[model samples]
Target: MNKPFSDKLRAVEPYTPGEQSKNNDIIKLNANENPYPPSPKVIEAIKGFEAEKLCLYPSSSAYALTEALAQYHGLDVNQVFVGNGSDEVIALSYLAFFNSDKPIFFPDITYSFYPVWCRLFNVPYETKSVDKNFIINPKDYYSANGGVILPNPNAPTGISEGRGFIEDILDHNRDVIVIIDEAYVDFGGYSAIELINKYDNLIVVQTFSKSRSLAGMRIGAAFGSAELISLLKAVKNCYNSYPIDSVAIAAGVASVEDDAYFKNTINKVIRTRERFSQELKGLGFTVFPSHSNFVFASKPDVNAKSLFEAAKKENIYIRYFDLPRIDNFLRITIGTDEQMDIFLNFIKRYLSSLSGC
Candidate 1:
């Protein structure tokens, strides 16, 4: 523990991830993970793996996975890049695009890791504020120097901006490499994969974690013109040559092959999200229109922190943040209808108890 670290890391506040509690049989809704397990094809893929393959190294470029994923998304192999996770993909973007002179820019309340990545690389960055309603206006980003990166259905709020609006920003800021992190896009948001043909500066990052139910497997990807992919390859070649392992490549290839499973899971999450939002609104909580798998809600009387604590006492787990505007809001991941019913039952009990108190 006495090893001296770089001075750049001294003041770095790394990201605080969602809790992974095993204390009780709670209706867990904290992280925005899929309520269901991954597709059977993914498991089957792993089951069919050869035992002797472990003796050899995984393909440095993960060629099989890259080809499968590229075909699944209708893109060329040269235009796609895969990594350990979209987090790493974003990290590479900073390495490829960011400079201390031209500050990178992202929404003030976006994926907290954006700033963390900047600090990790000693890259200066600026934060553009989202409006009072928590919507990202593309025009607000025109002034930033280095580039911009943001989630579509922005985290902790689940609000999404339209494709036309994003294209407008691309129109004006043609020089900057705009990275769209679409970790939760399948739930409802539009995919910028469609626009990559037109905008060479756009880099869309996606993950198998959220929608594909592979958080433990760690496979994320990015797509853009071949030029950008080559820059990412240069960085990837210098950093760690083998960012993906054998098992992950197999699971990732199978995950995309079973398109039916992805569609079914997305439908279920969307349905449950709507049901949860209506129920919360009926109970006097203000629910935002969520384009992601989670709903952002806040009641007038009970604060987010109190609600989080009360739910914990009842063996129900949801997410609550103490940051700026989101301090009062709770981010509840959409689970199965049965699982959510358990959570709602506990919440109803909490409200009843408060009335009597």
Candidate 2:
């Protein structure tokens, strides 16, 4: 039975996504999902889609969605590549650009998927440790390598690096590809899309999942030079040409077009995040300054794992990683004001009961 599996499959450790509970009663703040619903236009677009179109294959090129994103981001259509999800885009990126004898590099505490993709693609890679403060210094990534990939407003910690810092890394490693995963940029982080034109080595990946409230649609995209985009397209076609379906494409276009709704929802999440952060501090938790929709925090008195279990018992879900360097922190997504109030109240009671207050 073991002999039937591919060599790569045998060695691979799959990435674990945040827990998605089946209980509707649970306030899901584990995954950094947008608390609000998608734009009404996205719903209309999906509903208006012709059932007859399902009989035929979707456009392999995803032209309509690609063109819409290009227009939204002020890029040429050829510079944009659409995918089923940012995860797929990331996987394809590893296939397309990171194939080399030299090892690629990413922050040790960054997206867990980066190393997983490297293994799947047989791409050699190295991890650079982020500072004790959980900030990624651009200077650490100045070494030569196959390529580089890291999340901006990095996941779990939600720390964001500036454009100037990114430029410094690019300046040093001019010959290698630097992939910036901007999954949470719309919430509060600055996007690397602005630096794309100035640096040929830059590739910016973003998704509708977090900001546009379209995670169910599974729409994601990448922005790079035409040559790099073409390479990704080629790899994508080789794997699965019709990665994005008609329904998703239509909804994605509407999501991009409705900029006002996008802004309103993002602002709401940001406000909620800031409020949540302050409240956590008042409760004796050390909260990281998060530019993304989630906050990484720790309570000195209570164990994060214990609190995670305690929250789950009360129909609330938050992320707790048992991995080293971050085992103590809880990555809590910013839900609606009502939801956060419920969560905060629960934590307060839990801590009070512990101290017999």
Candidate 3:
């Protein structure tokens, strides 16, 4: 005999993260992870941490880290909500604001996790298709909806929408919550955090996993009106009171304080991404205009699944989505200049072999 599974469990298909291989030689450009390390301040903060504090519970509110983020973003402390990661913040937002008979709306090609969250929470959602170019038209979002959620500089496409476009969505959907998942904002996407005060229903969620080089810390945050933050906090309290631990809080505060390291690393990633995009085009790939840390591209002559296998054989990793509209494209993270150079060289050799040159 087996235990009965819940109806939700039967219906739910969990989100799948990008692969993490054990081989140390692999040049990992699959997941959109920051190639740089976290700020020295983060390491120093961890080194100086009080080991005795492990015996006590961490601050359930994550108050100190919240204050640091608040100062950086020019918001009141009450307007910030911290969670285990931005993914958690996103999941909590669904529970706090998106329960409705009217379906929430997101782009058809976007961060894959959005649909998973909707299914787990039992929130009805409709997937609105982006244009054939993979560009999201703001007009398509102007409709009756329970809520709106989208990632600017959309994943698997790496295209960022302008601030004016986001404002238009807010203008049309004034009655319901609009969640902007800004996980890649620091790369080149314009953050809607500036629009939060004007639109009470807008919630901008971000993560330290990308630009801050702190994916291991698992820190994510959200910004909105105080009332909106309060609702998320209430839901969080009901679930996990200490979503952020002491070490993570310390590292997050340190990462925020080191402005120089943050800008330097982000600038390097942006520069490398542009150069990589051009190199891909030279190799006969159609590289999309990307504002994120990765490029979504494909070649007319070569299949992406074939390239994925070829790259893996050479111990270089990139991502292939094997799904609708994007099956032929690969979302390759912009690693260090040296790493990308090696990847491009491998591509050249692969192309030469294919063409018998």
Q: Could you tell which candidate, 1 or 2, scores higher by lDDT? A: 2
By lDDT, rank the candidates, best first: 3, 2, 1
* Candidate 3 regions with alpha-carbon error over 4 angstroms: 1-9
Question: lDDT for each of the candidates?
Answer: 0.88, 0.91, 0.93
Q: Residue 354 lDDT in model 1?
A: 86
- Pairs with steric clashes in candidate 1: none
Counted clashes in each candidate structure: 0, 0, 0
* lDDT per residue (tens digit) for residues 57-109 in model 1: 89988999989978988999989999999999889889997764888878998
Best candidate, lDDT: 3
Candidate 1 lands at a TM-score of 0.96
Query: What are the RMSDs of all candidates, in order?
Result: 1.8, 1.4, 1.4
**Decoy 3 TM-score against native:** 0.98
Using TM-score as the measure, what is the rank order of every candidate, best first?
3, 2, 1
lDDT of 2 by residue, 258-280 (tens): 99999999999999999999999
lDDT of 3: 0.93
Clashing pairs in 2: none
Using TM-score as the yardstick, the better of models 1 and 3 is 3
